[model samples]
Target: MAGTTDSGTGEYGGTGGVAPDRAGPAAAPPAGTAANPGPRRSSWRYIGPGIVVAATGVGAGDLVATLIAGSTFGYTLLWAAIIGCVVKISLAEAAGRWHLATGTTLFEGWRSLGHWTTVYFAVYVVVWGFVYGATAMSSSALPLVALFPEGPGLKTWAVITGLVGLVFVWFNRYAVFEKVMTVLIGMKFLIVMYVAIRVAPRLGDAVAGLVPVLPDGSLLYTLGLIGGVGGTITMAAYGYWVNAKGWTDSRWMKVMRLDNRVAYITTGFFVVAMLIIGAELLHSSQIALTSGDRGLIDLGTILEDRFGVVTAKLFLVGFFATSFGALIGVWHGVSLMFADFVDRFIRERFGVDTEDMVEMVASGQRERSFMFRAYLLWLTFPPIGLLFLDEPFGLVVVYGVLGAFFMPFLALTLIWLLNSGRTPAQWRNGLLSNVMLTAAGLLFVVLCAKQVKDLIW
Candidate 1:
């Protein structure tokens, strides 16, 4: 099926918007056209897909989680961070594979699994967004509101941030939005790298940290480290992004492999950077970060006290970018998924109003799905109530446990789906890939168990 043109007419599709072209030269590029794109040209775009995935994968919460691990256990837990990136990379690649091989939205895949799959996500997205939205804004606000004593209270800043992000997401095309995200992702990398450089770990300790050593009685923190590296509900959003990237058909298998590999490599670097900083500077320190998202704010304060106001400010600025990127990423990516889900639901319920029943192609029907922006609004605003309260332990624990479990769920599913005959033979996982992904799933299961225990006990 790869490298062959389909008989059906094609449409020009991208992160932008889609337009059909039944008779024009814009026919779906013959699978071979994509197959034979010069290596140099293909390479440039490959760099891009990875960046988008990596940028979205890292978030403020992941950083804080790494920081806390460092402060408490130092380099002892570095193995978990390394393990984390591997698991996330495997899971994310699998999601991308599903889209490329199946030509189906992940939502559709989940539905096929059972009504329960749909019900789980339906419940999860809303609850997760409600708590996450306010949390994201407050984390972004921490640096600004803290830096400018006269800035609006956290809630006010949060609202402004939400509205501002909403406007950006609502108005911009995908290309423009993705470019903006890439730039912010660079900023995050710069700040994280700078911190790592400053921390300067002992060569011996750093090497030792890479060797897995389960510290006595600290099984919980070990799992936390593995789970925290780059796991999120966002892991499931990879399929939608790949769709935006124009890799929808099986023709793009080779490119997809290169793309997924690059994406997770970047993800791994982002995680390792945090572990380096934590092990070098923060291990065994008395500085305890509060469990809330606000802990990143406390990190900035610590940075400011030790490195000077400018350093603190830099971390804050990075925090804002990281949190806001997560906001916009969720806004743009997850919303796309949610919108598709809603559109599917509507079509299922109302039979797509015959006039509106234009059959949905792999790339069509995206704009009709408003689940994207609606979710952005939900993620940015409702969580504010939690900000005023104590960040209810029940919900936080719920978020942690669910969040921990999601990566493995995504991985194991992909392992099942992709390893099956469903994916193109060329794109299917080899024995080595299966072994690596299986390990990824096992690692997450361990992490999930730790989280469930923490939540229950």
Candidate 2:
């Protein structure tokens, strides 16, 4: 079912994307001392990628989920939100490990798994990107439209935002992209953290939330909160970000771990802040909002009424920062993914060799590649139509199903890849990793099933 072609620059080695150069066993470094050079760098230096992942992964929907959790169960579910960060930390760390240990992109790692993995991912990015494009733009636009109501309609703002994100990612390299995202994250943290503090979170109640206690009849919501706090397909993109950040060697493992923790710690703070808002604002007032992005708008209105217009506007701006940050992050990170996917697919299906394509991508050269721009267009232009019309019910259902399954897919696959011989032995999963990944896998499976059932029923 494969063919041969001769249309590539001959960078990798063999035809069809095979790098005879890279196919041999990875050079295993001593435990904790592989490719790392020099005395260990300060942990602060390795922080960009995690911020990108955190900014990308936690969007409007996640905040809504956290807000609702706090609104429904008050501070009781706070532990679940923190646990969610821990789970994601394990997943992201495993992903970064694969790239560092194996010296291959995650897509390359997936290809090593089987043709099925490649095919599944190919189908996934296309479908997921199309739907997510509209959703992200819309989410980003909500705050913009809120801020400037008379300027344009939501669809217009969505289109403009999409185009802006497209241009921004289409032109910038990883360094600039990271810098821009950091600034936006700074704005996001200032607004959300400020609001949370202003809400006057109860110290005793928050401390009690650190303990694991579920309120009556709230088990599923608690699980959803724990499982949903700051997860997305973007977690898979973490490794690519790691590679993009020039941390390809295993020597950077320690820094990567610290970076991952800081990323989720930031995420945990945002989630906790939203929970504080929900508990103190909604729970105390016995108010409930509708779910999803609109729920955020409702929350904005509530904030304005209770606090003031300035607070409401600030929160909306934070909402925009979170959403737009995700927009550009996915635009850049996933484009890198799709470009790798395309190059590898060509090699697999058509036998064209690109030689050092992995290096090309990891070095941020792919940001300017034709395939990366094509997928960027694919993510941008096609979804603008969805902003104009209602999303088709069937397509919506399929998107939901695929979205539901992605995290579990990531969890199980990381577990498989890390434990297998494909990875350097020294880089394989530790017992703690195995335990956490298994637990994450099971939790996501249950969550995925529930999502599918909800869609069907």
Candidate number of the best TM-score: 2
Q: Give the TM-score of candidate 2.
A: 0.91
lDDT of 2 by residue, 169-204 (tens): 987889999999998888999999999999999999
User: What residue pairs clash in candidate 1, if any at all?
Assistant: 133-379, 335-372
RMSD of each: 5.6, 6.8
Residue range 359-406, candidate 1, lDDT tens digits: 323334353434555666676556656667788777887776666667
Compute the lDDT of residue 441 as modeled in candidate 1: 79
Model 1 residue 443 CA deviation (Å) reads 3.1
Which consecutive 10 residues in model 1 have the weakest lDDT in total?
Answer: 15-24
Off by over 4 Å in 2: 1-39, 354-359
lDDT, model 1, position 58: 76
